[model samples]
Target: MKKIKLGNSELEVGEISLGCMRMNELSKKDAAEVIENALDCGVDLFDHADIYGGGESEEVFADAIGMNDDVREKMKLQTKCGIRKGFFDFSKDHILESVEGSLRRLKTDYVDTLLLHRPDALMEPEEVAEAFTELKESGKVRYFGVSNQNPMQMELLSKYLKDDLIINQLQLSLVHTPMIDAGFNVNMQNDPAIVRDSNVIEYCRLNDISIQAWSPFQHGMIEGPFIGNEAFPEVNAKLQELAEKKGVTDSAIATAWILRHPAHIQPVVGTMNKGRLQDIVKASDIELSRQEWYELYRAAGNDLP
Candidate 1:
């Protein structure tokens, strides 16, 4: 895997990171194999959430791999908090408690990064800032970021944050191209011209915040990947054509499409299957040209004005 300087942070992370949301469902033996394959593929970053399998994912990860000093030192671990049973909380107490629970579950003293899982409506920037300050000073979290937030939301939080927000996780893929679409259809009188994210991609780029692309292969919201889905024949055909040309799997083509962006979007693939994981990591070595990238975009049901 190729490495990229993650935004303005001091950490250099792999171009592709593994998402361990589903790892809780795997047995120790199966999860161990998955982690081994990821390490072999040079994937050094692992993403998690406090709610993943009710925190069993982190426990399983620690138990499965026996994460000792050597194993923990080899990779970077990141987790998100702030989401609760029926609401979101960014209070200082919740933020501090979340990281403490994560560290205890993962059997680690610190996580390389921590993210606010989602925007909390009642979030007070001052409280978040205080929590982050404590976490940073305590050596519990080295960097901080947010997920599913637009530019203005980020701006509001950054106003009180003492540290640079190193990352902003968002959804981006071939079929789910609203952010990219709004960019292309700017000033046009079309549905795609309606901006949804307040130009978050450009904002993050200007602010030196890396955008982590989650669900890289899914089409629509939780509709599953479009690679072999019969509903997306055109995109599938185009993906297969490019995959054949590049001598890689279609899934790699899908992932490469995200990596080809100039923003240096890092993909967080959540595949537990070792074979599929290896295939997706091939995207790091594949580069799609401008024309090819646009072609895939159009094939995914978008029209250029």
Candidate 2:
């Protein structure tokens, strides 16, 4: 439970943050127990979203916080907006309304960070900037960032917005890391797959924007969990070997693979299992060497060059 300074923001957040997307279906007591476990393990950053479980996730997280006032003050809370069921909206009205709803749901006056859930094709940078300015001036949101945005989109927003873009949440995992893999196999003909994310990893790092990796243990986009999936037998075999060597769970090994990168990425874990949460916290301490890091990368079939 080490802390890292968020990009250009004075907020020091835990290296591993807890994602509450799945807690909407859990009982209030159970959700409270899970959040308590995270706090006990030194996890201080809790991630939420307005669209997760149709806004029930934020309510459950707020209930957990209400169970303990002292804990609420000790942890940093972050949530995302701008995603609706049918389309994306970054309108000034939507942003303002969403933050108000989030504050009411989380039972907090201000969020540590507020992210635009996804890029809206028709987003007007000026409207977004106005919303941010109003929120910052009103003391509703302390920091701002974006999720699933490329460098060009970020630059577009930065051009009109006055606040620093602090983070970019991206779908990154050991098996589905096209952002890292595409660069290695850049010149392969007949490979439209060779071009993905437009080198977002390097772009964010160079621009001083922190990268938060979501779905860190998934093999693909919601197809299934990769922790024990049979399709990735070879990958699981290597994970087991590393887990044994590091004296941590295979899930931790998977998380470590993401953390071992020099980009200083934070893994926003979506696990609800208390044991799994503890294992991920332990994974942060298991530093993989350069060779071991690439070993897992190659095992995951990313060694094109």
Candidate 3:
């Protein structure tokens, strides 16, 4: 697996990180096996959120890691907070409480990074900064980030916080790339495609904030699977062709297409299958040529100018 610096932090994480959302449903032994497989495959960063499986995911991960001392030292653990069951909370109390709960559940004291699960509309940046400060001072969290935030929201948080926002996790994939697609199809009046998050990719690249891509294989907002789906047959066909050419699996090709971008997006894969995890790490090595990258983009229904 390839390692890349996560934003400006001293920590360098695997280019392909494992998302542990589904582990909550797996048996403890099965979850441990899957995690061990990911480590053996060179994945060092593990992603999680507080709401995954009603907090069972973090507990399972804690159990899995606590069972193995050696594995605990070799991997970096990252989790998210700020998401409530029916609302959002970024108050200092909630932030501090969530981090402690996550730490107790993960069987670790310090998270390599703690990302705000999502943007809270009623967020007070000062309160979040206070919580982050307390966590950093107490050695509970080393880095800070956010998920599903636009550029303006990031700016607001940055204005009040002292620490560098290392990452801004976003929903991005070949079929769901309005951040990239909208820029190319500009000036098409009345076209919703022409109006998306205005230059979020450029903003992150300019600010040295790493982009973590969640749902990297989904065609859209959790509607259905993209790989081999009849709605995306053209894209899947091209993915298969490139996968064969690169000697990687079709899933790896799909992942590589995202990694090939200059923005340096890290794919947070949600697969619980150990074999699928191995295949995803292989994607870090399958470099797509410029034409191949564009071919997949076009296959996703974007017109070439």
Per lDDT, the best of the predicted structures is 1
How many Å off is the CA of 136 in candidate 3? Answer: 0.7
Measured with C-alpha atoms, the lDDT of residue 43 in candidate 2 is: 82
C-alpha lDDT score of every prediction, in listed order? 0.94, 0.88, 0.88
lDDT tens digits by residue: candidate 1, 28-115 = 9999999989999989899999999999999999999898999998999999999999999999999999999999999999999999
lDDT of 2 by residue, 1-305 (tens): 67788887898987888888998988888898898899888788889999888889999888865734565688888999999989999999999999999988888889999999999999999999999999999999999999999889999999998789999999989998878876766677735346668789889888889999999988778897877888888789999999998899999999889888888899999888999899889977898999898888888866555
Candidate 3 stretches greater than 4 Å from native: 67-70, 190-193
In candidate 2, stretches whose alpha carbon ends up further than 4 angstroms from where it belongs are 67-69, 190-193
- Quote the positional error of residue 50 for candidate 2 in Å: 0.6
lDDT value, residue 196 of candidate 2? 69
Worst 10 residues of 3 by lDDT: 189-198
In Å, residue 223's CA in model 1 sits off its true spot by 2.0
Candidate 3 residue-pair clash tally: 0
Best by TM-score: 1
